[model samples]
Target: MQLALSTLGCPDWDLERILSVGRDAGYDGVDFRGYRDEIDVTRHPLFTDRADETRSRLESAGLSISALSSSITLCETDDRAAHVAEARRLVEVGDTFDVDRIRVFGGGDPEDRSRAELARAGGETMREILSIDGAENFQWVLEMHDAWTASDDCQQLLDELPADNVGVLWDAAHTIRLADETPRETLDALGDRIEYVHLKDAVYEPDHNDATDDGYVYAVPGEGDLPMADVVAALRERGYDGWLVFEHEKRWHPSIADPDVALPAFVEWFRDQR
Candidate 1:
C-alpha cells in the first residue's frame, strides 16, 4: 500500500509547502481540498490550465495527488442540492490532477439531529450522490465516519446503489466507535465495495475526552489505544489492497500536536508494520 498524508492537517498552508512537507515526510501522495482555502489550488490558473506542469512539479519533488478530500457529506437536508453541485465541481478538480478518489464524510451536520434522524437523512444523501452520472473518472467512496456508520445502514445503501463506483472509505476509528459493532462487522458489510481506508489512531475514551471528530480521539498510528495492529491484520487477512492514508484532522482538533511531531511518528509506525 502506498502511504499518503491528508493535507487537511495543514489547512493554512499552500500547495508548494504542503507538497514539500509531505514529500519530505516520506509520503508517496498528498490529498487536498482544492475547493477550500487549504491549499487553494482551485484559485490558481495552472490548476485548471496547466495540468502537465502541475503534475511535473509534484513528480519532480517526489509526490502525487492522492485525492481531493472531504468535499462531500450526506447529513444535511438544506444543503443536499448544493452538495451535489459542489461534488461535480470538485470531481472536475480531481480530474485535473488525475486523482480518482474523493474523501467524503458521514455527517452533513449530525450535531443538529437525533440518532434516528441522522441515519435516515444520511442514507438519503448518500443515495443521491451515488446517482450522479459517471463523468469524472473518480468514484464516490463514502467514508464511514461518526455519523451514518451502522453496518446495516451501510449495507442497505450498497444494495440500493446502481454503479460499482459507489463504495466505502472505511475509517478504523468509526468501526471501533460503533456502540454495537466491531471492525470485522463493518468490513464484512462492505465486501467488494471497500474502496479505500483512512488509517489513523486514537485514545479509547467514550465521549472522547480528546476525540474531536468523535468516533474516537485522533493520534499517530501506534501512539494511542486504537487496535492498529489488529486492524492491519484484519485488512491483510481479508485481502484489502487499496491505499491506506494517514488522515490527521488537526484542522478540526489539536490532535496532531504539530506536523513536525506527528509526521515522523506516522512514518515510523507505517514503516515498521508487520
Candidate 2:
C-alpha cells in the first residue's frame, strides 16, 4: 500500500509547506483535512481561487492528494440540506485535486438512540449525496467513527444503501479501541466496502492518570497496541492496493508530537514493514 499523511497533523502548515514537507518526508500523498488552522478547505483560498496552483504544485512535486477528509456527518436527521451542500462543496474541491475518496462520519450519538435507527438515517443521507450528478466519479466514504465504529453497525448502513460508490473508511484506531474489535473481525465484515484506511495507534488506559475521556491516548504508529502488521497483511491478502493514511490528529490533540516528528516517523515505520 502507498503511504499518505493528513494535513490535520500539521495544522499550522500552509499549502506550500504541506507539499514540500510531504515530499521530503517520503509520503506518496497528502490527505487534505485542514491547513493553517482552517478546517474548511472549501473556504481556504488555496482550494478556492488557487485550486489550479494547488494541483500544479502537487503534480510538480510528484505527489498526490489521496483524499479530502470532510467533517460531513450523515447520521443526523436535522440539517439535511446543509449536509448535502457541504458534501457538494467537498466534492468540487476533491475533483480539483483528483481525489476520489471523501471522508465523512456517521454522527450517531448512541447515547440518544439505537445504532440501527442511526444507520437507517445515515443510509438515506448517503444515498441523497451519491445521487447527485457527477458524484459517481467519487466515492463517499463513511468512516468507522462515532456510533458507527462497530463493524456490524457499518454493515447495516451498507445494507441499507447498496450503491457501488458508497464505501467504508476503515479507521484502525476506532475499531480496535472503541468497538473492541480485532482487525481480522472488522475486515471480515466490512473489507469489501473499505475504500480507504486511516492508520493511527493508541494505548488503552482506562485507569491511567493521564488519559483522554475515551480511556486512551494517541501514540505514534508503531509505538502502540494497534495491530498494524495484521491490518496491513490482511489488506495484502485481499489484494487491496489503496493508501494507508497516517491520521495523526495533532490538529485536535495539541499535546501530541508535531507533524515534523510524526510524519517522518510514519514513513520510516511503513517502509520497515515493506
**Best by TM-score, which number?**
2
Error of 1 at 37 (Å): 3.3
Residue-by-residue lDDT tens digits, candidate 1, 126-177: 6676556653357777777655577666655455443456678877766676
Q: Which regions in candidate 2 have their CA more than 4 angstroms from the true location?
A: 205-210
My TM-score estimates for the predictions, one after another, are: 0.81, 0.94
Highest lDDT scorer: 2
lDDT of 2 at 270: 81
Minimal lDDT window, size 10, model 1 = 34-43
Q: Assess each prediction's global lDDT (C-alpha) against the native.
A: 0.68, 0.84
Residue clash pairs of candidate 1:
none
* lDDT of each residue in 113-188, candidate 2, tens digit only: 7878887888788889887777778988889987778898778777776468888999988888789888888888
